[model samples]
Target: MLLLFLSVLLTLIYCSHGDLIADTCRKTQYPLICISTLRSNPHSRSADVKGLVRFILKAALGKANTILNLANDLLKKTKDPILRQSLDTCISVYQDALDEIPIAIENVGKNNVEASDNASATFVDADTCEESFSNSPFAADNKAVKQLAVVAEDIIGSLG
Candidate 1:
């Protein structure tokens, strides 16, 4: 009987929070990405809307760091001047993204609406980086960064 009761309790908790995750994700433009990303993080089960925004901002920061590293790595490996120039641009924009994400995370933690605008800034950074790679080999990495920034921006926008 105790085991059965525990199972039911767990189910109730999951179902309730699952609904919240689903409902909140629906507000974003990329509902599927929002749902999957939130559900993948254990903290999302207990997070309110502001907490969710922070979670996404944290994720965006990590992605920005990764893309920045990729640009740095590619810059080291290439000999082409044009590609080097593009990588230089990507490196600059991604560094800006890295700087903005932490501010967004902090603002979101404080429940400041400026968090949304900060995320928009990150989105612009990603777009600039992606555009710099228009003919470069590292386009895919930059595209992923841009998409994550958009996801973060969309999720934050949903809060208002």
Candidate 2:
């Protein structure tokens, strides 16, 4: 009985794909495609590919968040003109990543959702939009976002 119980527990662990990030991605058409791919091509390497993609997406989001905080702080205290310009550039890069993070995370959640929904199925193709956005150019206007209204207004004055 103990051996049987262990086997069952292992099976459960193997079956579960873990959490979905949100409701919308789970319900979308792209996730359905991923589910189909997972079902039809169980022996293919794409399963591993999808997992790797998801991991990268998560990492990118984490990095974006860290950079955003750093940029915000830099924008707040320093009054040096050259330093502010450099900070603005960094803010752009960080903001670009920040903008893409949500979509990438949604894709991860969507893939998992589809996988979960088709537990008995074999394989499905993964969607690549989120992955694409992860590689897109970074935007820098985010420094302004962290500024107080008066400070931001002043910065706008300087820009003009």
Candidate 3:
């Protein structure tokens, strides 16, 4: 009887990919983003909670890098000194985000609680970058990075 119960429990824990993804996403603050992003990745089908957190952090890092590139390009093209200063600040923040996200991913993979703090730092970096482009063409891009970073932090925090 005990063996049978253990088998059933294992089945539930390692159920269909959709079941795992849906259940995990529901626990996150942004269910839609969590579900969609996890489902889009083939590896998420077999990944557990820590793996999911790593996936989110990596995705956030990619967005940060993209935002950094956009800021750099805009800075090169713009002539306004004030706008240039804002872009420079944004570029720096994005760079910091790029550094923090990888550390978060690594720590999460190791099951270390410090991952949450690193994720929070990335969110701050994204938030700071977004503030620099409040009324500029890159505002949307910055906002997207901020959202991704927030989602990453939320997922990391959920792990605890």
Whole-model lDDT values for every prediction: 0.77, 0.38, 0.77
Off by over 4 Å in 3: 1-15, 109-111
What tens-digit string does per-residue lDDT give for candidate 1 at 1-160? 9999999999998888889888877777777767777888999888887777677777777777887888899899999898899889878987888888888888774655677678888888877877776575556655555565666667666665
lDDT winner, 2 or 3:
3
Q: TM-score of the candidate numbered 1?
A: 0.85
**Which structure among the candidates has the greatest TM-score?**
1
Task: Please give the range of 10 consecutive residues that has the lowest summed lDDT in model 2.
Answer: 120-129
Candidate 3 residue-pair clash tally: 0
What's the residue-level lDDT of 79 in candidate 2? 96
Model 2 residue runs over 4 Å out of place are 1-5, 8-49, 107-160
TM-score of each candidate structure, all chains considered together: 0.85, 0.39, 0.83
Per-residue lDDT over 1-160 for candidate 3, one digit per residue giving the tens place of the 0 to 100 score: 9999999988876676569678777876777877777778888878987888788777777778887898899888999998898889888988888888888888885655678788888878877776775476666666665666666667667666
Shift of residue 15 alpha carbon in model 3, Å: 5.2
RMSD for each model, in Å, please? 2.3, 17.2, 4.4
